[model samples]
Target: MRMVTKKQVPPLLLALGASVLALVFLLAFQGWIAHGADIFLSLAQAGLSWCF
Candidate 1:
């Protein structure tokens, strides 16, 4: 009788999948990320009383 073996995911493949998911998330939120950074910079400038 032949035994059925479960296939395991390779570590490299797992890492690659995680990286791809991260990239997808970053691309999807690109606009929001830019907006957040802009807001943060504006607040920092205000705190420093920079009028430029």
Candidate 2:
């Protein structure tokens, strides 16, 4: 049996794939996701405040 080497995913392609998945989730759960995003942003802001 021959060993097969794994190829790296290109950055643009990876970003596109992630964007597609995010779009799907957004479409499926717009309200819940929006609420979660708001909570996440608030937490991020709090963390950044401590850093600055």
Residues 1-52 of candidate 2 have per-residue lDDT tens digits of: 9999999999999999999999988787877666866766777878853442
The count of residue-pair clashes in candidate 1 stands at 0
Per-residue lDDT over 1-52 for candidate 1, one digit per residue giving the tens place of the 0 to 100 score? 9999999999999999999999999887996676866766877877952542
Q: How accurate is candidate 2 locally (lDDT)?
A: 0.80
Residue-level error in angstroms, candidate 1, position 21? 0.8
Cα displacement (angstroms), candidate 2, residue 1, comes to 15
- On TM-score, the leading prediction is 1
In order of appearance, the predictions have TM-scores of 0.55, 0.46
| CA-lDDT, candidates in order | 0.82, 0.80
Which ranges in model 2 have alpha carbons more than 4 Å from their true place? Answer: 1-5, 31-52
Best by lDDT: 1
TM-score of 1: 0.55
| Residue-level error in angstroms, candidate 2, position 45 | 43
